[model samples]
Target: MAHESTDTASENGPELQRALSNRHIQLLAIGGAIGTGLFMGSGKTISVAGPSVILVYMVIGFMLYFVMRAMGELLLSRSSYRNFSDFAGDILGPWAAFFTGWTYWFCWIVTGVADVIVIASVYVTFWLPLIPTWIPALVVIAALIALNLPSVRGFGETEFWFALIKIAAIVLLIVIGLVMVFTGFEHDGARASFLNLFNVGGGFFGGGLMGFIMGFQIAVFAFVGIELVGTAAAETKNPEHNLPRAVNAIPVRVLLFYVGSLAVLMSVVPWDRFDADNSPFVMLFSLAGLGAAAHIVNMVVLTSAMSSANSGIYSTSRMVFGLSTDGNAPKAFSKLTRRQVPRNALFLSGVVLLSAIVLLVFGLGESKGFTIVTTISSLCFIFVWSIILISYIVYRRRRPQAHDESIFKVPGGTFMPWVVLAFFVFLLWAFTQDPDTLMGMYATPIWFALVGLGYLLLRKNPKHQQLRRDHEERIAQEKREAAAYLAAAGSRKVR
Candidate 1:
């Protein structure tokens, strides 16, 4: 296949320029994956599953690796797939594109809100230990909005550093944990061994079935940003090379940072003693006699939250931009600023995020904010993942030649898709298994119904109809041009 051309010059101004480098793409992926979810939520998972939380993370990480591999294969197979939504549309149908794009957009919007809440909570440590949480929540929302409105690279660079801080912190924790395990340093005058893996409850599956299932509740959060690499494909300098490398590294990173660190943590302190309300990393630092452990961990968690929110903005804006380009959203969103950034779409996302702050101000508590936003975000992820599997299934059936030629094919291609689909269905069922998540599960279809209604209303608009027609025409024109070029090349060779 021909390499995809970087045609940003055709765009109106600097706004459409492809400015991202390999460093940016790699860091963005890292930032997107390591978020507040890992920092704060892991403690809950560990508490629930004890030592079994490690396996829960590993299993989820395994499944997500295939998901990313499937995405990578499809993306690398064709230059036209700017992102996963485009691939969904091309491989499945327009409805797939529409649903996947908007669903993914809504996903990040909710996730961003959750991050905003987390950021507010983190700030409360110093600002107002007793003040109502909503005050800081609103402030955080405003600050994030201001940061996002500038330019895409500015956002990318900021996220890069935010993610870097979290990455560095996690690395340091792991290294410290390893040293303590090997050298028995700070073992409180006792020898520390690698026996913590089984010390919690006698084995790796220490938590049993209930603990395992409960672990999934929080473990899934760690994989939240795994799909983010696909979102940055369009902006990467060399997506074919960088995208695959970045995506492939996900599983290893999960195992190392999540499973490895959690193992050491449980070893250092018994699983039963792990605190659910606070970060285990912070707790570990405190146990290790670090004076500023709480403050340092708080700083790391704050950066982690910022990283997640920044990625949420970037991914949501791109999804909206892709939707607008495909005639699913307003034309104004498709209009890129001089920097090649989707300023209008980014601004709209900021507006939605700001609304979450408004909700907070009106007495939406932190727990409520998390449930409302994270559940909504999770629902969107379900929709996006479902589309990918469905599209892969379609690609398998309709385009056997392409399937055979794919460079990075999803293993167990035919059967694995069904298995993954079943896993998703199980997750949806799991959500409904509990009263808390049940609400989110029920809320998902309502969101879909709203999207359907909006589509119907917008379909009637003359401008939207015209844009759709124009997009279709453009696709046809591109195909014809490609075919003619191939035909001319064939004729020249024959002559």
Candidate 2:
């Protein structure tokens, strides 16, 4: 059995480059926080939970913010940790890396498929009702592959603009909505005022406890890509300086982008009035008699779908690349092009993404297909996030000195990770309460079973056995060095 290269910078080929500047990192973080779910799924969420949907977004955001902070502390703890997969491998053993890496890859692939389907079925068909859904789907798949192949910076640049468009659209919606509320704008004799939120159908919880619980099933998918900052941490130019900044601002982003936007939308349109199948953004503008602006809002929502798909491609490729380098995946994926882009992994994801075309051309029906993919994507993402928190808990027990010396500790410390994990369990229970999501929940275990089987077979390979040996040796060496350094510091302090 041959020993694999532990060097991230391979002696035989190029590695991923640190081309993403602070601006790119900031926007990538923002883009990950905002997903197509906000624009496309918010209508359904509002219908399900009514005005209380605002609180759902805030609570989910708060929980995920702690997950990001835990990730930030772990990534910053060691420069060698390319992402959570690396640290999971380092701290928990090789199997953790294998499962986390492949699971995260699958998570994004599911998300990308849904994004492309929405682009083709919902947005493209809006303007070109006569065109086949597969046309735009294929076009989007090709364009995202091309956009990412050029460089990491290209992906960052694309996300920056895509995210900016989403932000502008939301800000414009909030501003217009406020004006409507203050002026007592009326349509069908229902005045647009702040009171409308609680005054409508059932008040804040008008949907009742059951409806509010169902809101979690719909809204959790909106935050699926929030951990992307962890994936991009290695490629960030100044990770220590920039990663915290990117993470610390998540609460503000959630409040403004998700909570703030939804509040204003519900305020202007009244929660019960929003159509579950239509974008609340489009509805808001259309009601204001801004037909042209409605079209523009439609375009922004279109770009938002594209952005999510684009991010899916970028993160999946990078994750597979990490898996390959760790000997969890094929060697070919570990090889990078001269541009420092993982071309092979990128093409693989794009090829798989073309499956969306089949779904589009066949008759899954846009709404049903979108629901299936988003449900599965949301469930898989929860698994990935739980792994991050689990790894953090392990890191804390193993490295208390590191935690004490850290500046960006998760606010509630070890206690908070347990709380968030409990919240996730409640979310899983919420899924069973709804038939649409329950099907996905039942289907999710098949994926894990397959991955578990693959891991079992890979574990038997001589090459993997040797790599595991090397991985254990590396962890032991790192522990010895850290202990020596801490002992020396203690001695100097005594003097």
Name model 1 segments beyond 4 Å from true: 2-15, 125-139, 142-147, 185-191, 459-495
Clashes of 2: 1
Best by TM-score: 2
Candidate 1 on 353-372: residue-level lDDT in tens? 87665665665645654664
Could you tell me the lDDT of residue 155 within candidate 1? 70
Q: What is the TM-score of each candidate against the true structure?
A: 0.87, 0.93
**True-structure lDDT of candidate 2:** 0.87
Candidate 2 TM-score to native: 0.93
Query: Per-prediction count of colliding residue pairs?
Result: 10, 1
